[model samples]
Target: MSTSQTEGLLQQLLQEATVVARLSGQAIISFAWLWPIRGVLYTLLHPHVILSVSRTLFTSLLTSAIIFTVLAFFTYLPQAAFLSIFTGPLGPILALLLVGAESVFLVTFFARALFLEPALSQVFDTTLVSRGQNSLVRDGKTKYASSTKKEGIEGALVRPFQALSRDGLMKYLLSLPLNFVPVIGTVAFLFINGQRGGPGWHTRYFQLKGWDSARRKRFIESRKAEYTAFGMATMLFTFIPLVGLVFSFTNTVGAALWAADIEARENLIESPRANAPNSPKTNEGDVRAKAE
Candidate 1:
């Protein structure tokens, strides 16, 4: 890269790092943005939301154990040996933690893809109903209803991929190499991934709002700090093996509760964007025109 390009890259990384440090205060408020704790409480009260966990628990644990052992066998010794160059004595413990985290991440990613989509959508919609945002759920069902194909939340699941973004997955894969940098590298990996993880918790809400990409971008950017904090928190909580799978559901409920609150406050539950006949066709153009 040229001098200008290199300088620009450094500036970008610094800006991203600054984002976490700056907005974490907003996240500390406990009830603002996506209050993850609320999700846990909500799940505890509603046993149905956690039904998805029971289904995936065995598979998630088995896969985690298999991956953990494999990574330990092939990677632990070398990764620890490498870290010893820096920490000397702490290398073995650190390497074990890193391997476990990596296994959890991989299992969480694939396991979510294979089994969690339909169940998660149900969780969000169920929470929405509890929040008295039943109309929004009806709207989603009507919009996606097809006698020949799948109906209701099933249709919604494919578009948002149960809140999993392909671009985000690609970014995550690119970030995995960051683990090689030792301790700072591990922190960077978590921080970088957390940037997207928080916003991901809201994908269902965005879809329900019928938000175009530009509009969703604007909303998330406006509250980037809060989103980053939430994402970082999710990453930390869900970074554990086997147990992280449970946080995944809680976070979904939390996002739904947050979405319901937004709808209630803004009267957005009955908004035209979600109800208008041509919303799907016009939203992108409308968002661009407003931006201009």
Candidate 2:
């Protein structure tokens, strides 16, 4: 990334972190209301989360199992081996770090596949309604809601898995070894995993705007720096053990807030001539009256 891009990303990261922090209390309440029975019941009643879970469960479990197995094998390696670097006095610390990282990764990995779409749908609806925007679910048959009717939920859910299966799994597995590389390894893992998590959070935004896979891919690619920063912040927050669950919920809310901001910016850019105070149309009218 360029210097300006890096700065912009850092600024955005700070902004998002602030938003997440500010809204942490609200997030806790929301999560509590949705937890245990309510969340599952809502999913059962809605096509969004249900479809996402169905599409992602197999792949997510497979990927997670593979990762766990690899980690298990490495833990059994000889003391003189490379994996043993994180052993001895530093073993507990290293174990905690790995567990934190792994927990964040697995939770986010499954969440992106299963819950993100529904969460985004729910969040975007709430955002637009609050802003007085005309937000409709699929087919315009109903307002955006928990039970909004969305077409192609199956395809939408499957796409992420396909992408993950293609190469994302391999990259994730490879990143585990990086945790052994002292300071550099952890940083690298954060960035790499953050990149993986970024798109998932942004997926709902793209859906809200009715963007297709191609457009979504292009847009995310263009704004990679910004999303990486956002994801990195999220990954760090999720590393906080018990509190990570709260952060995870807050991250969804934060993602929605971020999407709302992006949507607002896009609107301004697209309608600049219409919304401008002194545009060519106004100027031409004034000139014609003066000529008359």
Give the candidate number with the greatest lDDT.
1
- Write model 1 residue lDDT over 200-233, tens digit each, in one string: 7777777666666899899988877667666666
Query: Which residue pairs of candidate 2 clash?
Result: none
Q: lDDT for each of the candidates?
A: 0.64, 0.49
Residue 120 alpha-carbon offset, candidate 1, angstroms: 1.3
Q: Candidate 1, TM-score vs. the true structure?
A: 0.69
RMSD of each: 8.6, 13.3
Error of 1 at 69 (Å): 4.7
Provide the lDDT at 111 for model 2. Answer: 54
For model 2, residues 1-292, the per-residue Cα lDDT tens digits are 4677556645654454455444434434433222223323333454343243343334434544555455445643432244456555554455556665665456546555564444334544454333333432232223223224554244232122222343455555556665776656766666665655666765655655666779988987776656555666666665664444334434555564455455556545655665568754434322232232
Candidate 2 residue-wise lDDT at 172: 56
Q: Judged by lDDT against the true structure, how good is candidate 2?
A: 0.49
Poorly placed runs, candidate 2 (over 4 Å): 1-91, 105-117, 131-151, 155-166, 275-292
